[model samples]
Target: MSIELPQRPFFLAPLDRENSGVDFLGLRQANLDMMGEMIPSINNVTSYIRPFSLLSWIYWKFHDLCTEAGIEEATSDDLRLFRERIEVLFTWGASLHETAERIPGISATPPPDQDGVKPLTFDAWGRVQSSTSLIAALWYGPASKTVTGLGFLSPVPGRGGFFRVSRAGAALAQALDNKLREDGERYNRLLGTLDPVEANESDAIALWSLWSPETVEHEEMASFSSALTSEEAIGSNDTLLSRRSTTFALARHHLQEVGAEQSIPKIRRGMCFSVRPDGSNYDVPTTLEECRRKWLTLQMRQLQRLALETLLSWCEDQILRYDVVDTSAMAERFKKSWALTEYGLGEARNLAELIFKLDTKSNSVEDFIRSVNTNDLPDPFSIMAEITEKFRQRDPGFAVPCFFGLLQCASFAGAENAPPNMVQLGSAPRLSLRVLRHRLVGLGDVTVAEAFEYILEAMVISQHFSTAVNRFDGRNQRLRLAIEETGLTALVSSAWVPTVTEDRLAMLLTLSAQSDLVSKNFDGEFFSNGGIKNESI
Candidate 1:
């Protein structure tokens, strides 16, 4: 049976401009609906989860696994990708036009002979006219265009729609101004109260207070309006520009340079694409792409951390609601039957213990949300920060179920995969199967059979190293022995082609072996275990 969660209105944290009561959650729902209509891959409700934390953890974990396996080649490839990304950032900064020229298909200029004709395009991005409409299209996504055409928010007189929207935008700007002023006051107060040692620790907060509002110049607003409305606007780049938060930063810096003195216009209503206005200053390297890469990367990290924080908060709240206060007390609580509970206390305890190190002393959920600083955590992709130390441990226990649920949501796995055997089996085997299923399902867009082969390939590569063993357990015996005695490496290597049914069955059997539910000989194959039913496979 599928895990059917109670239906509730989907919630999306508001963007800076959307803070002016712009119906952020409504817009996100509409966007999701529109995207589902446009792209088959994103049609499922589960697709909305966007589990960046889990995905990043898996990738970094895989990297660690590769290093442990002594697959130097795979590790070296990671280094290559890292170096290339840095180089790409440098290139993006130096000259966007030049970089576009070097990348054959990437073009800053329109196609030959089509430059003069006005182009209107529609696709997964919805309908857009040109750069002129970019601000509107991106702010509300498809909602702006559709809502406008329906005359709900038309620019036509007496509609009051644009007026309301414009007012909303104005409200957003006012809110930011108010916040900056407040932050400035707070910074001064802290500076005055704190000693030198304490002051040094407050640098990040102080920088935030000082730098955020300063990034905006009161004069640059008119130039920004001009850039949005200019006759030279093209729609193709508008989609790219709309999705990019750094574009706003670039525009602000430009207006500042040109000395445009108009107040920054209230962000138009429906424009919810702006990143949280932390007021980071950008010296703006020579190229737009560099600025974009830096900003996007930073926002991604921030977003992932925010999502994780949200999850942790929810988990903590669940634990508190259960009134299980002490860590040691959880074990006793677990002994009681959890038949009526929506989730076992065992599960809640596991999640709490895992993230216990990261928990703060906030009295309420709101307080935690307001005060928790994501920057205090390690870098976004760091396993210790995102997945925490619990996952790195051999058995994460009670945390397994919730994480598996998250993994299912992230992968857009159909309901058919649910009510897994783990539900009936005891917790230990359940955890192993859940982890195995996670690895199996998380493999790149390939069929289960192909995924099986991919794992086999990793195992084959791993077998070459005599020291390699399953990281799941401290002992390095089974996999190593299977590799050496049964010529498992040679067998798997010979079957390097696309996956066949038998090969998939073999891999499933191997997973069963890993779970200790099946007996295995020196060869990496499973033998009959009377305890496991055929349907369990």
Candidate 2:
């Protein structure tokens, strides 16, 4: 996302416009023709301009121009002009050569030559011998005046082979080496400066070492062989086979360690099973079905444990977030309601009461549902719908109990027992009686019964089972017991039982509320007073 403008395009003007006599199109065609003949010569002279192919071509062209100019036997002044032109061409070529040498993978050494004067000469095969030959020819023949005063050429005997070494030549070689060393040092520094997050020094070093001439030559040989061999094997099947074998071997070891003898027979049966005796490509099984089954069972068992832990954590977090008004009083009330003969119910009730008291100001069905951070709460509507569908597939009539069981789970205070019931409750009966009764009483802010009925219908349609009647039943029972303990309900009737109604749904709701009230009271007391401690311990 770095916002930066792109570079502008570069356009080259027509050469004909710069040189009136030059036909840009014709010149290009002529150069293409010359390129066909000069490739071999260019290759031969490449050594002198080591890394620069374009520079080698330019040097050859300058020599050709000198020859065409007929300045070989010209006056000193004319020769000076010719030498200056050739010198400019040579300088340009050298600059290009140096640039090519800096690029990774390009050869820095120039081509060599035997006959120095005719540096542009090619062998019978049209291959230029070396860059040295090209440079020597350019200097001695075309730009000879530049080096004549410098004593670059020495006279030889009758054969006309002159011993030649110009100060410029020596200076250029040193300069090339120095430039190369500087470039190498800069490259090393760049490699060292790379961000550790993107690339480490080791990686940079490996890349640099890989570009060495020796490494390149070795790689070239390997690549050439690979190219020649049409069927080059890049990866080995043996490695895959070894990995699969190791996995099965590990599984077998684990089975033996666990003393699972039945698994051995299963494994043996799986191994012995045959699909077909014919040599068909699909006859063999790629995977061990028996091993996979055993692994899945183990994985499911681990997942069940994780699910329980997650539920426990959710409950703990919910309780921790709420504020209790009267922990001791709530605990006492909880103890008496459940008729505790053991500590299990007492302790559980005490914990529940503490949470309830603390969260009393903010306590609501929505808060409770939100407190349960299980993955099940994310899309309750869809999840409930899916469960209902699953139940319908098994037995449509059972969907009601399935739904009620799910509601019960949402209302209840435990975790380990919720999932299986929630899953199976989809197939149960429509126990709306208890749910309806609780909704009427719990949501008594509206005096009209129609409002409660509307709420119930909406709850069913939206799958918002979190506010179903059983939750109110549980909460009311706790509230009544708390009131009893505190003597706050002396003026009101305490032993009232709601009348049963012909509306089956209403009756069911009332019945559910009554049942939950009695159970919660009894269980709360039992746990509060350590009645169930022995059983649990």
Candidate 3:
């Protein structure tokens, strides 16, 4: 008999395992180093502002200055905030030191010999430095903002539609396109190796497993016509089909109750055949079992579609925030650890292609929904769900991406994953370090409570939160300059990497529930234990 060795515990897994090391400490340091370069002053503003926000801030500042100088025309049109305007603003801001200030009070003032001054006051080299710093910040920042920064917004009040791309932003978008093309070619090659029907069935089977534990049977899943035709049940639960909740527990609870899912299928089947209250069917039922199956299948399809769209939205946003070609240790570490799964990589490409194909300058959920054709076909969402579940199980690399999606969604609270608003109720990113204290301990390379505390404290210190003002005044040159030369980079580059434990996923639901950034929430255990409160806000 062959001897076998027991699998090592996840926490004790060798730190140098091919793909299991967590270099969050190193990433944290690099992020800190990057933050040092972002601020105009140390005491005045936090370096927590991300790249697109930095770009937007620059764009708006440049616009204000140029308008003051009578060089650029000002319109209330939101669409005017694109790259052309950005470029004009950048050029003007870069060279502002060469001309007198338009505002009377600051007219004759010299460029402050400070580190954190506004880019407009900086010399040519300083302007370039500031731009480069923003670019680096983009490279280090969260991925969700990238998509929104480059995408066209649909028209809303006080704004028409606008689609703007800087040369760099356009290049980043193209890089994503090329990456997607490569992924598509790879998936296609994989497809060629499998039997078409078997492959389709396999994909379907995989996705269906994640959607529900129950097998499809010949019975009707729900009462379609009975619920609708009855006067007493019109607004009751019987009329509505299985409304899938995001949580596995709630969904399981619903299943145990034998309520929504059992009734909704009948309503769907009734509608499909145009069954009327007159006891006359406009169309005959082919088979009750088949109709039931179809109804159940349709519901799964809709739920899965919604979930996939939500995930894809988050994915694209992350991709746009971080470029495919980013080679920094931080970017690569995140990609290898969490962001890039085999399926997720493929999905990212699909999202890129889908986004690139958009001809409309302004796009919305309705537009996205209209673009997909769902008539008389198998549910695509089921396949996606299967893919997501498959990779999440087999791919150790997928853990972080799963966590990230959860975090992103928590930040948005079902809104489209656009740029995050820190002050928003659901801003998970802003609140992640603050809210997820007790749970964050014993996760990944974080062995001791002190490790978690150190990381959390670092994240808070690195951010630029303000209770008094909503934004920085763009006037802290000395502080910004000082942080740039802080010399923390050398120490971070040499930090140790650690193995991750499985406990991180244990609190996934709790973390998801705490996505609201503005809430004065605390982990119950952390609170009861008298742990220091999250003072980030």
Q: Highest lDDT, which number? A: 1
Write the residue-wise lDDT of candidate 3 on 107-161 in tens digits: 2233333344222222322333223333323231221122322221112345332
Report the error of model 2 at residue 366, Å.
Answer: 41
Native-to-model Cα distance after best TM-score fit, residue 278 in candidate 1, in Å: 21
Q: Provide the clashing-pair count of each candidate structure.
A: 9, 51, 37
Give the per-residue lDDT of model 1 (tens digit) for 51-144: 1111122233334445675665443344323322222222222223221112111222222223332121122113232321211232221321
Tell me which of candidates 1 and 3 scores higher on lDDT: 1
TM-score per candidate, in order? Answer: 0.19, 0.15, 0.19
Model 2, span 290-345: residue lDDT tens:
32222222222222222222222222222233222233332333234224232111
- The 10 consecutive residues of candidate 1 with the worst lDDT sum are 494-503
Of the two candidates 2 and 3, the one with more favorable TM-score, higher being better, is: 3
In model 1, what is the error at residue 219, expressed in angstroms?
2.3
What TM-score, to 2 decimals, does candidate 3 have? Answer: 0.19
